[model samples]
Target chain A: MPAKKLNLRKRYGLLTRGMGWETTHQKMDDVFPYDSFEGIKITDWDKWEDPFRLTMDAYWKFQAEKEKKLYAVIDSFAQNNGQTNLADASYLSAIKLFITGVTPIEYAAHRGFAHLGRHFRGDGARIACQMQAIDELRHQQTQVHTISHYNKHFNGLHDPFHQFDRVWYLSVPKSFSEDALSSGPFEFITSISFAFEYVLTNLLFVPFMSGAAYNGDMATVTFGFSAQSDESRHMTLGLEIIKFMLEQHEDNLPIVQRWMDKHFWRAYRLLALVAAMQDYMLTNSPMSWKEAWDVYFVENGGALFEDLSRYGLKMPKYHELATAEADHISHQIWSVFCSLGNATGFHTFLPTEEKMAWLSEKYPDTFDQYYRPRFEYWHQQQKDGTFEFQKGLPQLCQVCQIPMVFTEVQTDPMQISYRVTEHGGDKYHFCSDGCKDIFEHEPEKYVQAWLPVHQIYQGNCGGPTLPEVLEWYKFTPEDIGNYIGSQDHARWQEWTGEDKEVKQA
Target chain B: MSDKKNTVFLILQDNDDARPIIESVEQDNPEATIQYQPGMVRMEAAGRLVVNRETVEENLGREWDVQELHLNLISLAGNVDEDDEKFELAWN
Candidate 1:
């Protein structure tokens, strides 16, 4: 008799799951102890589905081929000396932001998914989380390897690993990942997978990758393509997990809704960095940050929630606030970073005439009316050789850790938006009412937040002075300040045979 | 041209893996026109654009799932109608 072949779906279904569990030595609860602590009621674990239906054999084979292709590109890029091929040296500032703020989050996500893979009771969910865990680790490795080529000649790329841990601006991402990592398995998956990956990921990945391509950075583009391929599968897992949980029990609706609201605001605030990078840092930006938000969020995100409404879910709280702030958020944050460029780990520059015109065309409602005058004034001061930098430290929000830069909801944009609440005989400040609500719900968790500005006053950083703090952050004189006369700009001019100093003399 | 405003379009990242998918799109929707950008490709057609999973499978010589279209998808500008066999985008 000849052996018979099996169907792929049936074989994957059987091999990936449906292996009967043995309880001879220990009970199920004892083996999976962390499954039930979050007050989440899963009536039937069998309802969970792996939408990708990927088997171990196919995953390894496909992934190995992708890695081979990625490495080949990286090798060619290095051999051809790709560092001198950028649109301008100022473009590297966005890459600096990515390495410091985003790469470490990948490592944190890998750790969180590894824990979820072990702890979830559902076989389908466990397998999906385990695969995502491997994908995240690969993302981190490939990202570091791809970007490390620039470190050979660049200044700011040297201490990103160390800076990610100690720098003030970086606490935005560090604290975000730590928040997700510290939660239970359900909330962890809801935060990183559903909120960050499904709802907010394209805003972070797409613009940056396309900007890299447009600016001639092929190394970053290769890494972006590799990582985004895995992201589609992770997104499927995210959607599947939400549907699985909501379908498991009707009681899960309120819990899931609350998680969505909380994680949405958290993830949205973290994307302020991406918004600033897109609008201000890229020398040859593909599109405006407002346009990307309109395309990715208002269009796609609105449709996604409409689909989820079938399961008794609604749009996240403060969804309207996010829509309203799209025109102003990036502009406001770029202004703040420009004023405080002396303290940042990346270079900051006022927009060129070409870029300012693009901004005015893209943001006709806000840029010309509100932000253009301020940027033009700065450009005038820069021409006069008065190089201004904001002198004082900003009061950081206890919940989101951003400076108090957001404006009041209906009031003038000049007035800073804030909410003060008394918790344990101490007043806590938040940037918005949404953040205030989050703290009021979990006062105990948020009261212990490590606010960066507060730590500096308390002498937890290097010293009291600005230079000492900059030293503690591992920044050289070349890494910070305005981009026009910075070392990188000078070198770029020399490389392109457009050195302005000699010609001016 | 103002015709672009009336067209439904899809943009995908350009890479070796997307070749079969592009071929499928060209074969299935003959009225569609293609444009190239740095590191990406765009397909535009008047009124509608459709991507057939069977066509993609024929080009790639494998079983292709419609959901796999997202692996190369960058952006699209129309209402989507998707199922196990087909993915169609139209202004309606």
Candidate 2:
């Protein structure tokens, strides 16, 4: 018996060449037109032979066609005034979190892959980088476009890109992106593309997007899955590169391990947004963010890190810490939303009794006693027409990029809350010191966070008026103000014959 | 990518639901062995456990692609060792 020799390039070319990359949904048979990205070669695609080994023509055609079909759905939904069937008013909150947190990851991927486009010694790796670059851009754009649809229907969406710059809790995402963007190009690839996208992203995308499908937000669901299809390839590239590096030099082991350790923690913290959206916002069969993390981050990832220990790299230093925090983080974040909705660019409504029950079932430790009462008060206020948003901005955590809402983890799992520590003249608050240390690692990068409240205070936003501030944030009229009265809710009412606005108190 | 044999470690949920998947592997493939713990399954195979696409679909009684595997997975960690034809998932 002869051992088979591996040719990564040949395998890659088999997967991608001549696929009609240009036209969307022409046919599964159309190969990726090498001419699509001129002068870039996909043959080096062999760097990591995808076991599912999607051939080029089928790959491009399926992808382009999927995008095309998705776009058509978007068009029809918009044409017939389709935003309303979106199931519930609460769903938009999930979109708010997605726009604020996940979309930035696309841009971060763009920056990282762009570096891979430069660093890969082979044309194959470099070409994969090019495709990834385009994919990331489209992901970012599609997210923005899909989210912009809600702008006319909700708030908290004005200039999400800019909002990312200035929002308090948004610092969580902003800082994560900045961290990935700042790493050496290869490390960036491992952290964002491989570790974040390939390893953990499926947890967020596949399930959540499927949830979107069940809800009325077809556009969002479509785009999320479409982006994920591309992510499959990017994941391969990430896996290959890390593996290739390990193969190239034994010394690369420790270096790669260090990066793996650094990046896994960095990416995990950014996923806190998923914690909130999954557990709190989804209209149906909501998967608790904590459970999602256990499966996605802790179990899947923690297991992987243990395997890598043979290389002398243990699990990411913060893995346990991040895992330990998951069951509690979403409630902590939404706690801020409930308490601070007025000052926010988006709306936060009290969860229904049914939803509250679901949450209590999911978060047994804190919900019934700690968080639910607070939401109950907000519900009462809503009934009374006296609910007030947190009037001002929160101080942003320098490292995690979140607002200082996180609680300290006591020896007992029962109590979790926030801890603040001061560094120099600036006071740094964190969900925990793990986040604080992640920040202390590169305070220079994080110190410059653009907190939304800070911007409002600095008068850097449009003006003193919320609307004016929204405008400065690049949010349009439909993009700003109370979500209940926003366009999406209005459209939902019209479609369901329920009427759009909640009559003013 | 390391000179060392690539390994994949998976801890399955303790629920009784995944028994079929566990049983099928143990019975169908002599190479497949599963040790059950309090809340998880520790599966260690010397090399990749090949699941014919056809076989998986037949067993699951639905379209069972790689993505759908997430359903049965309690937790999985492994290196991707492969060529174009097959990718191996193994324990170190």
Candidate 3:
């Protein structure tokens, strides 16, 4: 008789935990130096659980099937001219943002997890991070391939990597990722896997993926489904890591809390871009950014934190401020983009009157009162031939790297919420108290920030003139400016046989 | 058990990947309320909710690993205990 096959748990144990052996040539401390420096103590590597029991054989089979399905959908989308079926050409702006701002971060996450896979002492964690590293790379590749179909027909889709490196707004996401990548392995996983993938991922993915489905972008929706399955594993790994840390040693609570406080604010600030995309970019919006925040953050995150309270972990600091800003950040960021439209990779436009009405309905408390009039004024300026992109560069926050556009919503919606600090004889600006506090904790790290606006003034970004800077950013004239008469808009009209005159009006 | 404070819930993205798991959950936890949102489904029960691997595999018509449930899981509220045979959530 054939020998009985090992059960799933034993098979996983042999494949993972059983493979790890004590190092004889090198000290374990010398081999894994980075994990201890962050002040997190793991008393026993044995306590670390394998959150998922996926073996390499099963992983390859599952991912291969997913890839096969994804590519088939992408091929069908290309064959059927999926671009022409979108809710509007305006919807592609969101995809453009995804490629430039979000896709590069996926690559960074791949690098981060690869580092973790190497540095982690526990075999379970190493294997998990290794799988996630591959997943991140897969996400980056699939996103590029999926959105490349639109690159053939759109203006702003080209040169995403080039723009991601040098562009001003893109720096927000770039800096956020770099901060995570540059941290120790534990903090990297805590910041990314826990704070981001688990706590805040739904806010990002749900909006974009659902927006794609709602707007008829079949390729993006397919990739969203494919990536989301992997995200689940990432989220579970996040929870397991945090739980393991908290359970191993009582001393780890405060250290974990501090990292959560800092990284939560970082991840939340990075999500400001997604807020803008959800609210203003999608022609047929799935839900308002505030509504998504309520569901994903307020409700779901509330439950998660409540569960975590057993480990003495509380809700992140400044969570109340984030909740308050949800009503306003999307509008604020969209306004900033509209002001600097000429300098951006994608076209920006004042919302149509219908969209403004939708915004008013969605944000009854803030939109009509605080934001609608500003958009109306911009619309008037365009109609009068007096509209121009803001000529002066906006001040960027030292920590978050977003422009100082957020307001003191808790006190006065009209007052810009600016915080200032001094470090190394240099005054630094922050978008909020959260960013300022993060800077104070590690002024050494933040002072080295590559503020793009300052870089341009210092003659670093391919000369001073706006046209020179645009050229350096790899942006064509068609790539920047208002979406109404832009090349993308015109091509969309031609493809869909819609009247340009009607669209312009 | 009917107290709101005792409630434990699990949310999964409502898609083909989760359909079998959701059905297994419905079968195991008859007392739970299953509500479908736009693209997600939430399963809530008083005090406890459990996912049995055998039931899921039966619903899936193949062998299923308990950890594969995370592929569809969106969020959950409660302390979790899991092994090869079952995954359980409760307000312990």
Candidate 4:
């Protein structure tokens, strides 16, 4: 008997654990381009299995239903001329970062998840990966469609995807994602699902949704909230997958820790964009980097660690480093925005005196002493046209691909700690050796970082100058920076004033 | 072969608040057929959802910002055909 065929119950439960896992996975030929993703491997399809136990019907039913709900809101808004009464066009400035930075990351996710759907060795993993692939596609499509309407009425809504590839600071998100996608299946799960999905998506999503509501962008708010709901499932998958891997073998502990350390710093570094948006981008309801990190990292992470401590992995290596970092990211991002605001499509007026006072009060530890001085300098230099750009090029980390952000903590008195590793006669610089240790475990792996500086020196990004490269991108002047004092701000004021009078009448 | 009874599918209130929103949907899709009842209006569309600000402005007594319409929507059922637009509702 060539492995006697058994009943469904003998192999897996009824519509549970792994139903249609093998069959649908075997249908990879239906999707095309499978052979090209990697070499042919029939065993790969057998390895695919879903943890969520979701079959095709449930998947389509849920997705179609979700799309319908989302479309209804869009329809209702259009029917009601809901776009007109927006609190401020300045609000779209926050989305400018998404259009330029975070949105493209979804495309990267699509590519990565599609890869996972192929290479993953079980039906459970394959199905989840496929669903994630579709989710990424849905995200990209809906975002473009939503933003297209604004493109008609607004200025900066054009070719953002191309801009993402060539832009300067945008390399932060790009390099971070490509690094994760380049990794093996296990590390990809650790970096993206565990670190990015569960740990950081809350930080990104909550603020985006809240800001959309405050600015009266209903469709963005609705879609963001709905998308985040699916993200919770992905987060759970990350949590379960991580614990499952760790428990499977004792040898997995150090391996798991190395990945945890590596991805924590990598993910944290890319979140500089979120840090910038929270600190500087929003015109009306702004959040500070410190406050967001406190709630998102310290509090949420504390709870998660309590849950995961049983798995032999500890809280991320740089918990102290990040907690110390809270004091610095806001001021750093605000500085970047203040310098670059003029060329940006978003607005960045000086914080109102009231807002300045609030900042001083909120950051009682360092705001007035460290951040306010720069505000005063820019206030004067902006008038004098003497503000200088930190031109030339930023030295990106070998692994994370962000410009080096590690520095001595302002609050701590006597610690100049940094992490580095040397492998095969080449030294790699990381913000934390936590990342470097992961790299050293397999030096052949991370040496191929797509650092923008390296790329420009290699003539990869259409010459180094910002304007020259911007030409190679899909961005207009409107998609670049700060939100206040922009054309949209003027229109916001114009529309709000007229609406007020009508309401009063 | 033919099952048709003068169908009353949707109901709407004609308060001035909703006229702008109701009218905007009608104008954008153009094919949307609307029925009006005492203190209500019922509109139906077999196609994609359309929410353009300019269309709503042409019909209302006065111009209104998009956020204000959240107060006017009572209930919705069925599915939204296309979701490329932003939506608002009354919720704290």
Interface RMSD, in order shown: 5.4, 8.7, 3.7, 17.6
TM-score of each: 0.91, 0.74, 0.94, 0.71
Error of 1 at A208 (Å): 2.2
lDDT of 1 at A214: 84
lDDT of each: 0.82, 0.63, 0.86, 0.61
- Residue by residue across A1-505, what tens digits does model 2's lDDT show? 8877436446556444533133356632243322222122223333544433444444455557556756786777777656666667657777877887678768877877776665554455556776788789888988887777767765566666776776555666776777777766666777776678756786777557766776767788767766766775676567667666665556667767666766776677666667677766777644577776765666566555555555565666666777767767778777777676655555665567777888888888767877788779878887799977766666665566566666554464444446666666877666666666656766776677665666677887778887677566555665444567666566667657873433211
Worst 10 residues of 1 chain A by lDDT: A496-505
Name the candidate, 1 or 4, with the larger TM-score value.
1
- Most lDDT-accurate candidate: 3
For candidate 3, lDDT tens digit of each residue in A457-498? 999999989999999999999898888898888888888888
Question: DockQ of every model listed?
Answer: 0.21, 0.12, 0.30, 0.02
Worst 10 residues of 2 chain A by lDDT: A33-42
Better of 1 and 3 by lDDT: 3
Model 3 regions more than 4 Å off? A1-3, A499-505, B1-18, B31-53, B56-92
Summarize candidate 1's per-residue lDDT along A325-344 as a digit string, tens digits.
Answer: 88888888889889999999
Residue A24, model 4: lDDT of: 69
Tell me the lDDT of model 3 at A41.
87
User: Chain B alone, model 1: TM-score?
Assistant: 0.91
Tens digit per residue, CA lDDT, model 4, A372-429 = 8778876677569775545556555677665565556654422433567777787788
